[model samples]
Target chain A: MAESYRRSRWSNALFVAPYLVVFFALLVFPLFWGMWLSLNKVDLFGGGQFIGLRNYARVLSDPVFHQAVRNTVVFVAVSVPTLVGLGLFLALALNKTTRGSSFLRGLYFSSSILSVTIVTLIWRIVFIPNDGLMALIFNVLGLEPIGFLSTKGWSLFSVGVATVWWCIGLPMMLLLAALQQIPADLYEAAALDNAGKWRVLTRITLPSIKPTIMLVAVIQIVMQFQLFGQALIMTNGGPAGSSRPIVMYIYETAFIRWDVGMGAAASELLFVIILCAAMFQYWISSRKEVA
Target chain B: MADRSAFSPENLTANRTLFWIAAVLAALMLAPVLWILGLSLKNNQDLMHGTDAVFRAPYTLKNYADILVNSQVFGWFLNSLIVATGQTLGVLTLCSLAGYAFARLEFPFRRAIFIIVLFGLAVPEQAVIIARHQMFNWVGLHNTHIALMLPGMSSAFGVFLMTQFFNAIPKEIDEAAMLDNTSQFRIFWKVLLPLTLPAQATLGIFTFLLAWNDYWWPLISATKKEMYTLTIGIASTQTNFAQSEGLGFLSAQAIFASLPVVIVYIFFQRHIVTAVSGGAVK
Candidate 1:
């Protein structure tokens, strides 16, 4: 029996071996490499000398990096709250509606299936000037065409709108599922006490879905901070660098300028931001549960 | 349940208003997609003429004809199919083994390994693209579909998701198989594997979508135009055919590119709904 148990233990290790190899090689190695690279002045084709904290200091002093940081903050500021609030609102609205609710839910969630590429492509055409769909709509409504993708002031906002639209589906679906999990008897009980829809929503539904909401918020914030494709494709961080998010900056630094070291530094900065946000969220959510 | 007599007439009116509002919002969400479809069906002249002529213009299959006959889109579609399907199979097979191990087997540093895998979920793919490219180049796998299929084959999300699903399966089944003198590998294949259909489907769909829509890696790795995926193909179509009356053709190509995934979704919408909702349960 002990021999069999020992054999089983060895089998278990063998079963998990492939995953451990790949995980360490692909994910963990690059992560630690990135951390190391951030601290050194590494080149693509040559030997790198260790330069402690210089890359981080350079990133801090760089104007383009500063711009990317500011742009990312604005994006998170605008996009995260909208995504969370709109997701919740839509979830609540769909939850209340009994007619064709499932069908509508499916339709709303279908947008999420279209990869970020497709979403960006569709919106790129939609936001094009004069001959574009948005322009056509504006023409019909006697409103001037808005250069959503071109103007510096509105470029990030336009990308934010598209990003929100692309991502809102996931949270909406999650929140809807959470909302459905709430016991109907609680609502019925509240109704027995003459509670109105708004009152019941405030008293029962909000509190019930709070955990899911917090989860969605953290996930959305992390995702928004890594905003890349839309800026890369739709705006190209153009019209005076207004829409250049951190990931785009990282991409440009690594691939375009061949500054792999600087890009690694930028990515490290992003990792720190994401790690902090995630830890704070974990703390907040756990605290709420304890309370 | 409350009696109908308990609610006021004003409450009924308000409820009706709210219901309509939700319905309207749902319709509005679908408007852009409908308009894109409409625009694809119109000719160059009609599209150039703008929204007034959007519905009034004579619908034509000319754009579709042009794309089908003139472009490399069909080739890109085939390429996407090869990559997506290969990556999906790879991820499913690898993740199932890993997930099963993590779920049922007790090994040294299991929790540490699981935490490492979970951390990959937070690290966006873009963060590692530079290092990935360097590795691919070092291995001389650059510019190959294998390069695309390699990184995605061992997904952290897949392992995490499948682990959750496998954990829910009772251990008694495995014990019963063991008592019957079945090997552990055979049990995984013959006993536990068949029962993980829903989880497998979920992983398949998610993996397929990720592989299908990947643009950056393909863009970086694939230097040749023939090697371009659908996303890069469409972007280049605009630039390459800039002077030609190709907007309509571009739209047609876009629609064609989008069709496979749309058809897949339509057929498997229920599975997708279950899978996405299941993800949140993680």
Candidate 2:
């Protein structure tokens, strides 16, 4: 009996041992090591004395980091609503079970499957000055071409548009699934009451999928907070750093400038922001279930 | 309401209105894709003069031909394939084993470790990227496929998904296998593992897509030209931002790089959609 028990425990350890090793090495260890690195004056050459929060102070005081934060905030603010709202709109419109609906869902969702590089490449063609699709339209209208990507005013906006186009698919799919789960009987009852379409949507549809809306919103927020590639490819954080995001700032600081300590500090700040968002989601979801 | 008669006048008109709206939106969504496609077929010189030349004739496959002739593009393509497939298989094996342990086996510190894994879900890749890169660099693993594949294998999301899936299976199956004197590994491999195919498909498709599309880690870690994945390799091929000189060629590269993902999406639409929806809400 003792031998059997010991063998079973060893077998159980075998099951989880590999993942735990990777988990510690790749995830857990890196997380705390990153925190420790944030306190030091490390660079690409490695090994430096611990500076004790001076890196954080410098990163916080840097003006470029401020702009990157502002740009990231602008991105999350503008893109999250549009992604969630437009996704909900698309889901509601395509909620009906028909051949056309599924096809349209697929068409919209197809873009999300694409890599950031491909999505940005397609949008760059659309937004490039004087000869892009947008420019072609402007010419047709005899309107002067605006530098969607080059100009500071429109650069982040252009990135937002491309991001929405790329990311709207996931929210749409999630909302559509939530909409499908709303029982048909609830809709039938609302119909029997002679409820107006808007009334039904306002009363029944929105409330049923509230949790999903929150989920999608928080997901987009966390995702948009880490905006690197879109800016990297689309605007390259150009036009006086107007479109640079925090993640890009981290990349530039660490990889480009070789300030690993400051980059780690900036990234830790980003991690805090994401943690807050995740915690907010947890609070909302758990409280929602209770209520 | 679902009860509304299919042929009712009110319903038909509403449906028509919805259809037209959907059609317009679909066109808007597809316009960028189609625009790129048109540009990809046109001559680079013509595109530079005016983007409207896409509508004219004399379209050529020279752009695609150029890409095919570049030996580096093929190398990048192969690298991306190896990394994505390797990562996906590694994630499946590790997650399923750990998930089986978490869901079924009674192990010490299981609850605590699982909580730690769950906490990992909140930790963005950006947060730990520098440290992870430094670790890999220290070990002289940077610019290698192992460097590309190893970090992705430590996916908390995969472990979580697999655990939930394994948990959903009835305990009776394991008990029945135990009655047959089957080893726990045998049960997991021979009996229980087969039942999780649907979950495996969902997780596998997602893992593959993410690994394939991943950029940040690859960009920094795989710095060597020979080590470049498709994304970094293609991006490297660009000589300038908003490159007008090789517009056709750039478009072709974008299309070519995305072709495999698009093909995978076409084959696994159901699984992809399920993973997207279920992965989030759950």
The C-alpha RMSD of each candidate to the native structure, in angstroms, is: 3.1, 2.6
Q: Count of backbone clashes for each model?
A: 0, 0
True contacts kept of 2: 0.59
In model 1, how large is the Cα lDDT of residue B6? 38
Question: Model 2, stretches more than 4 Å misplaced?
Answer: A1-10, B1-15, B279-282
Best by lDDT: 2
In terms of lDDT, the poorest run of 10 residues in model 2 chain B is B6-15
Give the per-residue lDDT digits (tens) of candidate 2, residues B1-282. 354563232242235577679779999889988998988998899887877889999899999998888989989999999999999999999999999998988767778889989998888998889999999988999999989999998879889989999999998887877877888789899999999999999899998999999999999999999999998887776647565888888898888999999999999998888777655433
lDDT of 1 by residue, A87-118 (tens): 88777666644446667767777787886667
Which pairs of residues have clashing backbones in candidate 1?
none
Native-to-model Cα distance after best TM-score fit, residue B18 in candidate 2, in Å? 3.4
TM-score of each: 0.93, 0.95
The true-versus-predicted C-alpha distance at residue A202 of model 1, in Å, is 1.1
- Candidate 1 residues B150-218, lDDT tens each? 788656888888898899899878887777787778988999999999889878987787789887788
**Tens digit of per-residue lDDT, candidate 2, span A157-194:** 99999999999889988887777667777766776777
Q: After best superposition, candidate 2 residue B59: deviation in angstroms?
A: 2.0
